[model samples]
Target: MAHNQLDLLRQRRFLPYFFVQALGAFNDNVFRQAIIGLLGYLAVSPQDKTLYTNLAPAIFILPYFLFSATAGQIAEKLEKSKLIRITTAMEIAIMSMAAVGFVTQNMVVLLIALFATGLQSTLFGPVKYSILPSVLKPEELTGGNGLVEMGTSISILIGMIFGGLIFAVAGAQGPWVAGVAVILLAITGNLVSRAIPRVEAGAPDLRINWNPIPESLAIIRLARKQPAVRNSILGVSWFWFVGTVLTSNLPTYAEVNLGGTPTLYVFALALFSIGTGAGSMLCEKLSARTVEIGLVPLGAFGMSAFMIDLYFARSGAATAAGLTVAGFMQQPGSWRIVMDLVGIGLFAGFFVVPLFALIQSRTPRSELSRVIAGMNIQNSGFIVLAAVLGIALQRYLHWSIPQVFLALAIANVIVAIYIFTIVPEFLMRFLSWVLVRGLYRLKLHGIEKNVPDEGAALIVCNHVSYMDALILAASIPRPVRFVMYYKIFNIPVMSWIFRTAKAIPIAGAKEDPELMRRAFEEIDAALAEGEIVGIFPEGALTKDGEIAPFKSGVERILERRPVPVVPMALRNMWTSMWSRRDGRLRRMRVPRRFRAHVDVAAAEPLDGASVDAQTLEAKVRELRGDAA
Candidate 1:
């Protein structure tokens, strides 16, 4: 069954990225189409094609390599919320410039407009990536990246189609509609960007270096110092490499290699981008919102494998390589290429999404812009290199287009092996991933009734054993803050889990007075801010089949905060996971009810202003009431 990745796309935070990108895409298409149409119109008229058509792309792309170094430095040096706004404002200016060209009917001015748009995009490159680490969690990184990429490709497709239709239909009056459309979309993009939250730049104090070549190299060097970060950036760069090669040549490939009309180019690009969008959203679902680095190699494997198959699908056909959209659909041999191309696009989703999450999770927040800048540099380098490779292999090497594609496919495989070997995190995750396949089927009873719908509630649960926190964390959709013992908080691998969950650590008053005070302070602060905070009152491990005495500590907490207390009982813990023989040995096996029932019983708000400790203890005991 096909998974629905679109669920993640519905998030309010993601909407801005989607709208902003789509509008930007629409504008890009409007501009490109204006130029392309003008050239095509000139083909029949007196104007020369070489002057306008050849110059547009070069003018646009030159800014990325030229200004990316400075842009990266600026993104790192300023607050990201402001930088994104500035970039979008730049878009407004760029679009306005294009509007002038369209109104004045000057090709030279329009060419300059394309250059301004590229410059805006270049400045945005580092800011876009760096901001994600600040806004999203580690697990969300890959899915977010995927969505951004998918949205971008889809926008490109829409833009191209829109641009052509508008130009072909508008005649000499084309620029007015196109210009107005670009300005409106750019304005919309700017508005959406204004909603983006502030993100701290990684290197606020790092000195700006104006020289693009040297600064770009230095950013690259700084990025490599972090191993995992460097690899994740490489992963993204390679994606751009593959993507640019495909996007740049697909139209040419359809026209020259496949003997197809211009319409098929639209079909091919749109389908591929749609496939990527689907894949990006699916990453969160596939990885369960964790850093599933393992999928990196898996995606690479499929990408390479499918590209080779696409090559095979196209090779045996003797018919026209490119066909009109209608003509291509009618041919049997061409359908194989179409299906193969779709598959290639679909697999791209799987391959690229996780890398985004990895970068966010692994890189230092302060150096994120520098790291992202390094990534952009690599991406630009790869784009140029891939274009060169694709064109050179086709023209100089005398290789068929399909054969050159085959070389790229094989290269993906080789790169996959090299990357996985260098970073075992990807491979190691696949091993543990098998356990996740066991499937967690939930059975709920009185969960909604027992758990408070709103208001601050201090949950007092009997911490029976393993995964107590994980179960509670997963069960409630609303975020919860758990006040855990410092000992448990410092547990070797669990620290990261605790950190991500935003767990607060508490120590016994005698053991550490300062920490205990901090915990209480945190409790009051959380409740005052109208957030949910939980506490487990049973101070120590339940060694035998008996409830430990309720700690007076909870009473003290309630006295100060005066919030409701939710009493929770975890079913079947002592029988399976209690530490009986010191800390080294285990007790009974995990309960047969591994999916045992849990009841979060919310009693009334405590009588904090007047109640004695004994009264509060009695209230807690009544709530427990033989539940476990």
Candidate 2:
């Protein structure tokens, strides 16, 4: 059954981990903000304040660069639950030290504590993500990631708000109050971490690498070997890069361009965060509870569009001073700016959730944590580079911040084109989404419980149209290897999509024995690896919109390697423009149907040894009924 994203919050495995991570994020930001606020309260020199403020973010992110590789190794080598508990304990200790620094006003202790907190966060990063797949079902992964992203965003906001408010109200004793609060939060996090179920080590026998630089490079190399994992890492890192540029400039942008005060800054941040939370929650609905990469392209488009609009919205505006939040809200064109920020964030959620889910779902369990760690390292690198690029563009190139927004927006287009081109699977999936959801309304019957969520199963469906495979491909959440006639597989524009999807192209034994042999061999290999394989028993598109006679190929394949066989039927597709009812070539001359209704019925899996091509064909024919 499909459950709401919020439903996971009630489960023990997910809820405990969620709060622990949320509190940890909350504490990190609170402590960091408390330090900066303390500096301001002390009336520190502007030069010194600037130096420390600049150094704070760098110090915090440095651990991701210095320790992420090692973190991955440790996470893979140790039980994740225990590791998380240990890391949470470390957080408590670090916060205790920070509390001392806060009370004594000791800069050294505070900075050291800050670095320690960063290191602690680095250690926790791998375990946090790697444990999810172990705890949740595959169908729950998208929802799980959505909740995590939403939690983190909201936590950052709350941390900032409370950290500033608490420090100000406490006055001279503010640090002491902040210190105790953080330590308590850390302790609470540790207590929650104890409730997380133990997950076995991913790579228990792997050797640990002590060195950072070479190990980090090696980890990245290992992740780069898988094209999907590598591209997802790039996409995720680019998100952080763009996000850092936009967020880091908000304070100055609000003051100089919009003439807003601190409250307006908070309002803008809230809009972005709220938009992200809303968008993340919407991913499951948009994807029908699947990890849909199609949303990524859609998100990238929205992010770029809103960013470009933001550039125009603020462009050529007169500078204003002492604008309160209420005053800014009352100004002309304020709503446009607000909408642009929110829309950018909303699309950002759409863009990011799927990439994270893809990384989690696609990467091998043994290497998932390491890949995520490499992603963290790259994310940090991109964030730092964004800072540098922003500085250079502003100082050397003399480009305004809004102009930089324009430049980044343009860069996003190039990045999207390059990514989509390099891995056409993303674009192919987007097209499949369009064809299945936009061009036709798909209704699935008995698919939820009938189709196994994991493991190898053979799906046998009656072929009614050339688009049968594409429809099934988009409809099924798990990636499938389709077995299709070689000629159809080689269809001009679709050949690229077929190849990208790793569709197996087969020929009849009499026509081309070699291709048939290879196709069966590929099918066996795919099923052996626990992948789903789909085949049409009729071996051709229907000529009269009727079920064709069953062939012996299915029986022969099952004899070689037995696996459960699922029977499916596609109804109401024979009259579609892509169908062969009017003759394949003649159908192409007909106008394409839009918003056609298609029903896909999948029955329970039959024992492979008991089922043959004839029985499966009858089952599918019955499932199809008189719909055609």
Candidate 3:
């Protein structure tokens, strides 16, 4: 299995998916920009103009509310690669209609085409997510998703600028050109889909639900059946709600409050999308190929903080005159505005990627498409709500654009407060932050850079010391759930840390057969669903500082649910007091000038057919070079 995600993207399967999705994204923004630009230039009144632009998204997303459930069912029932082809074919038809609407200058036809395009996307949703698990190794999901996200956002920015500029340059012919481009893109996307290796139907007998309202509700109930799946979906939905509200209102704030032309509004959009792109890439780079939910809160915190600063930083309106994007950057106070937008976008990526990966990682493969359908349902609903709320703030409450920004920032606090109360794990992660703040943190090289940003992973390490768990836990940027020997689980004080980290304890055959059974079961369940499960293949901490003989437990776990096993080596860890043969074990009183210097060297995940304890141990030894 691939370690670095950048390497993964170079492959045919992933790149096609990436570009196809990006093309769809560009199509989305290009058409929307065309409509918004035309409305800006032709709408009779300013009031009607913003209403028309904001309202466009609601109408288009209406299909998500209408078809996500049915689409999800379709995805689960049919072959996904074929489903992608069908969706691309549908895009071609939709773009053709859009071209006619644009050429005839028919607003009603345009709206219909926009909604039609949304319908095509809604059908594509389930297959889009389901294909990741089907095509890429479990470890490749996070970074794969991250790259897709970055490319999509950049595509949006490029499309928007392209649409606006092209309309300026071509006027009446703009939409015709955009339509032909979209059709060509769709055809290319379909060809790419045809190249994807076959992924059979996940649930061939899955039933379809045609009605939107009840079907949408049922999808949520389906997700609710699994705790991790539900949390992941809820987290995913929350990100969308926050994102929709911010993105919907950004253009208005940029024009009215930031005191700039439409070009500046475009700049704000670009900056925010760019920031989100950075955050998405960061998730992969920081987590070392694991889906780390800890960063979710970190991202949320930055999002809220930056949003708040943005509102407060606004000097009400531009003092002297309007400024372009370049001029705005040069303005003394405007830099803060730009930075806040960038940070909010960046944090949004952090907030979004893991949540998505979490859903993929935690949800059962059988029902993954349905759960994704539920997530899309929530997203579409929330986007509608966000648009309504933003418009209502302006039209009903008579709030200025900046006032809406301030209110949304304040609302972030309330929303976070509610979600944390519901999910205490987010709050629990904060405790680690507090503890680490009082301690020194050791940095590892290419450790986070080497791992996939999403999906399920089984990490195997050589057992040497009791502190191995903590060393591995702290070293990986992601939240790792270690499967430790039962004896250590009951240790005083440390038990709480294990509980907080959600570590699972296991026992040997003679120690407790029943407990060992349960431990294996948990490991299987976690890996089968896509969560990370770390293990020490040596069975127990060595009596000597050297690596011990490999055991069969990890092999047993792999037998239950086959996945990639990434080997990691903790160098110099044996020299620490936690080493099995180091002078003292479990003695916290050892002298400490500073924390030990340990290097986490990662090896490519073992292929399932070739993976065994002996092979894995040898790889670990090679990674370490000399004995620790």
Which candidate number maximizes lDDT? 2
- How far residue 540's Cα lies from its native spot in candidate 1, in Å, is 20
- Which 10 successive residues of model 2 have the least lDDT summed? 584-593
RMSD of model 2, in Å?
Answer: 2.5
* Superposed model 3: Cα runs more than 4 Å off: 40-51, 395-403, 424-467, 470-494, 504-569, 575-625
- Candidate 2 lDDT, 1-628, residue by residue in tens: 4467788888887899999999998999899889988897788999999999888888889999999999999999999889999999999899999999998988889999999988998999988888888887666788889899999989998898888776678998887898899999999999999998878999999899999989999999988987877998899999999989988888778888888887777788888988898888888777766678888888888999999999999975446777998888888999999999999999999999989888988888899889889988999999999998998998899888899899999999899888988988888887777666776778878776677878899999999888999988866768889999999999998898889899999999999999999999999999999999999989998888899998999998888878999999999998777887667356453435677789989998999988888899899989999997
- Give the top-scoring candidate (TM-score): 2
Compute the lDDT for candidate 2: 0.88
TM-score of each: 0.70, 0.94, 0.82
Better of 1 and 3 by TM-score: 3
What is the per-residue lDDT of model 1 for residues 1-628, given as tens digits with 9 covering 90 to 100? Answer: 1122354466555566556766776678778877777666545444467556546777877887788778888998998888878888889999899889877777788888889888888888777777776665443565667777777777777788888887688877777887887888888889998876556667788789888889878888988887777887788888888877777777767776667788888887877777777777676666655556656776787778778887887753336754678877787667677766776777777777777766766666777777777777777778778877877887888787677778888888888777777876565454323322232322333334445544677766666654556545544323468889898888766665665556889999889999999998998898786666877777766666456777888778877887766555555334443333134454345445453444444455554456544565566566557654
Q: What TM-score number comes out for model 1?
A: 0.70
Question: lDDT of each structure?
Answer: 0.70, 0.88, 0.75
Q: After superposition, how far is residue 319 of candidate 2 from its true place, in Å?
A: 4.1
Clashes of 1: 8
Model 1 ranges with Cα > 4 A deviation: 1-14, 44-55, 103-105, 198-206, 211-213, 256-259, 316-323, 333-335, 438-628
Relative to the unseen true structure, what is the C-alpha lDDT of residue 197 in candidate 2, on a scale of 0 to 100?
Answer: 82
